[model samples]
Target: MSRVKESIEVDVPVRTAYDQWTQFESFPQFMDGVERIEQRTDKLTHWVTKISGVKREFDAEITEQIPDAKVAWVTVAGEGEQSGLVTFQPIDPTHTQVTLMMDFDPEGMAENIGDKLGFVDRQVKGDLKRFKHFIEDRGTATGQWRGQV
Candidate 1:
């Protein structure tokens, strides 16, 4: 398994950051390889992504969720095996620290090579940076989900 962890500080409140993150459909805006995310249900999501010219689809189930705190998920059915968690920590009313941790098994030669070379780590970092910009630029959440799971 390959694990990647990345974090970024955003100039937004924890609620704002967590709210924006709950809008999974907006991930394509900041996530590099994501093509689309469909919220099938409150705890289920379908994702389409393309990385390094390779495309894949997957269904992920939210394992645990705590509003303004954390969200955890695992791939239920997909072309790959993976799990991830994202957490939001309040630094101040106008500042938030967001952290993402992912564990995945490379499925193909290309993916394996990328994992071994730290490509996945760099990608996670870049994604977090983009997310920081996406949220900080807006200065507010596009939407919010407060339901617990």
Candidate 2:
């Protein structure tokens, strides 16, 4: 497995950032390669992605979630093996630090080569940067889910 971690500072409170994240379907607005996300339930999500001409579909189950703090998930059934975590830290009343970490296994030769070349790392960094812009520009979360698990 390969791991990638990236973080960004957004001009939004931790609560706002965390709330926006709970709306998983909005991920395609900022997450590159994420074609769509369907929130099947509070703890389950289905994902569709296409990167570098490879398309994949997967289901991920949220393993842990703490409002305004962190969320973690692991793939249950999918075209790939992966797990991830995202955290929100309050830098101040109007600033938040969002961090994302992911672990994935390279499935084939192309993926193995891309992994060696740091493709996933770069993608995650870019995704976080876009997320910063997405949330900061909105100035408020599209929606929120305060439930804990």
Candidate 3:
């Protein structure tokens, strides 16, 4: 397994940032390589992603979720073994620090090589940067899910 951690500061409130993240289907707007995300249930989602010419589909279950604080998930059944957590910290009323940590296992030669070469790390960083822009530009969440788990 390989791990990647990245963080960014967004010009938005913690609640705003966290709420936007709960809109799983909107991830493709800022997350590179993500083709689509379908919220199957409050705690489950289906993901379709393409990276480096490889396309994968997976089902992820939200293992833990705390509104305005963190969200964690793991692949329940999929083409890959992966899990991740994202946290939101309020710096002030108008600033939020968002962090993402992910763990994944490379399946084959291509994936193994890419993982070793820091491909995943770079991708995560880029995705977070895009997310910063996305939320800051909107200045409001598309939706909110405040249920606890």
* Candidate whose lDDT is highest: 3
Q: How would you encode candidate 3's per-residue C-alpha lDDT over 1-149 as one tens digit per residue? A: 99999999999999999999999999999999999999999999999999999999999999999999999999999899999999999999999999999999999999999999999999999999999999999999999999987
- lDDT of model 1 at residue 68? 95
- Full-model lDDT for every candidate: 0.95, 0.95, 0.96
Model 1: per-residue Cα lDDT at residue 72: 99
Each prediction's TM-score versus the true structure: 0.98, 0.98, 0.98
Judge candidate 3 at residue 139 and give its lDDT. Answer: 95
Stretches > 4 Å off in candidate 3: none
Q: What residue runs in model 2 are displaced by over 4 Å at the alpha carbon? A: none
Error of 1 at 117 (Å): 0.9
Error of 2 at 100 (Å): 0.4
Candidate 2 lDDT over 1-149, as tens digits, reads 89999999999999999999999999999999999999999999999999999999999999999999999999999799999999999999999999999999999999999999999989999999999999999999999999998
- Candidate 1 residue-wise lDDT, 19-104, digit = tens: 99999999999999999999999999999999999999999999999999999999999889999999999999999999999999
Candidate 2 worst ten-residue window by lDDT: 118-127
